[model samples]
Target: MKSPRVLLCVRQNTLRWDGEPSSLCCSSCCVLRCFDDRAAAARVNQHAHGRGTRTSLVRHGDPRVRLIAAHRSPLTALFSARGLQQITRQQQSPATQRRMRQQVSSEPQGVAEDILHLSAWLARQPHLPPVDDLLLDRFLYNCKYSLSRCKSVLDMYYTVRTAVPEFFKHRDATEDSIRRSCEVTLAAALPRLTPAGHRVFVHRLLDADSRRFDLLAHSRRVFMLVDVLLHTEPVLGAVVVLDLHASTWAHVLRAPPPLLRRLAVCFQDSCPIAIKEIHFVNAPGFIRKFLDIIRPLLKKKLNERVHVHTGGLETVGKSLPLHMLPKEYGGEEKSLKELSDAWQLALERRRDWFKAEELKRVDESLRPGAAPERAQLFGVEGSFQRLAVD
Candidate 1:
């Protein structure tokens, strides 16, 4: 049996060489022919660099090199350690450049420019809501930064807002009745974004009193807050964490299927923001039954994203980061009380804007296409069965 032959490369006096027989004179680097003789290897090293090359570490100012066993007849020069380092440096530049380009492309200035262009386009259209930069940007964002989709969503948003007067009409966030309903903390959008850049919204029934639950007022507040978010921030998507702990049968009975249907249509169809996930934590068995009633009405994609976490917060934590959640949910963030108070304060500040929004209705007669029929517009029908309470 023949011993494996080792090819050697040496860098002496700042000149590098590899063990290739074809080229004796080192132009760039040379590879020494594979030899099994230890004495021959030592002799070759002494002649090449006045020292043995067996040690992995070379002195400072010495060329970085390595030796590899070449069993095949043809000696191939394996890249030296320095050569590998150079190749790595070369490879990293493109990735760094790509990352820089991504950073520049994601700047808000570009988004602002797009919104300006959209605002100009909206200025020419009739019977539309006032096309301010903020509103236009929200439309642009909701449509996933597409101009055409933004226009469509803007049209549909107003059309639906016009049609659903019960929810949109008289939307005074400062009113005692509206404030009281919102105070229940059925849901509240967090002040921070998730690691994946999604806007986190937590929903849980704080009050068991069915009479004070006012589903319409809660829906209005939710939409109002959503509108505020759209106008205030450049949100990419939403993550809803629904905690159904402490919810009673009374709360289940108050779940109006028709209102749920309308809300589903509004978010799934009319609204521009993409609901990335709807996670139900501490979900009761009855919640699943309630979901079955509304599941048919929800978009298939959305229904698929709905996760029921009955096991507890650990189950919810698998999808949602613990840092993004409130302290009550075994997280590091502020308590739900603090979050809800901040949100309520934000809603209070936007009271006048909500009133203005409530009055800004789309005139169907002035619309370019055929007016949408009331029945098709609202999605309200007498066919929805009342939710049965056990």
Candidate 2:
């Protein structure tokens, strides 16, 4: 590689061209040499003046110029290294410029390694919330010392702190409050969390919060967001690290027909539009029955021109009203079974077994995907058997 350029100045009369001091060129003051041969004198002059090239060191009235002394030959030299230093001192602030030069020289060499070490440090921190008030304390300390690291750590602190509640699902909280928590925590913890530790700690904290809200209810919009998150989870673990439960998707799909249909309509206009496919995967068995019950109503709305398309029929699980089952049967105790059973027995005398397909969507594929899956039924035969045992 080419060396970096630096201007050099030789002091006057330093004609040590052959590594020896000559009478024509002394340690100080101008000197000259004369040759008996004119051609030799010209060659000597050219060599002394560096082949007629105007070196940057050349300046008007510089001591290196040959004085009109009868020394028989022209001599030349420029300022020395110490002289160059003196000149630089005149042009720069001693303390400030030196410091700036030092910084410029060191930054380029340190930058890449700094980034690597910083990232590694952030990765090692435990991902737990400050059980006390330590987060803001550490951040303030970092801001005072490691300013750049502080900014990065603060940004992460805010993002994870804010996203925590949203992903975990709890009672309603404002985005502003979440944002504030991040700011406060970062102010305390920036000094404490190394970059690697910061990243890992944030993740662990989020994981803990995620576990706390193991059972989360999604709003219609958030239900749609779940699909988007799931799609991008593989390549980058950040999206997937929150440990999303399969049941969360199931809950979204099992929303009532009206809610699920509304979400589907909203999803149609969202970016990528592919999130709609996630709804099918999240569908639950109860939602299937719910759709069966609402399909005729949706068809009637379509026939009357009150709605454009009968959309909810595709989500059969939404129709199941499984929430009506008591807590003993894995439901929210919504009592839909009691009401439906009462209605069924009320029309018992005029029972119709005709709507087999309509009443139960027992497709062959649904019978058992891998093993023999049993469908728990509350039909008359099952009820009669229970009554006899009682």
Using lDDT, give the best candidate's number. 1
TM-score, prediction 2: 0.16
lDDT of each: 0.59, 0.25
Best by TM-score: 1
The RMSD (Cα, Å) of candidate 1 is 21.6
- The global Cα lDDT (0 to 1) of model 2 is 0.25
Candidate 2 stretches greater than 4 Å from native: 1-217, 220-256, 270-272, 279-287, 291-390
- In candidate 2, clashing pairs total 46
Worst 10 residues of 2 by lDDT: 234-243
Candidate 2, residue 371: how far the Cα is off, in Å: 54
Candidate 1: clashing pairs of residues: 17-30, 18-29, 18-30, 18-31, 19-30, 19-31, 19-32, 20-31
Per-residue C-alpha lDDT of model 1 across residues 81-113, encoded as one tens digit per residue: 212211111111334335423432333335646
Residue 336, model 2: Cα distance from true site in angstroms: 32
Give candidate 1 regions above 4 Å deviation. Answer: 1-117, 120-124, 380-390
- Backbone clashes for every candidate come to 8, 46
lDDT of 2 by residue, 151-250 (tens): 3444333222232333323322223443332222110100111111110001011121323222223331133222222221110011101111122333
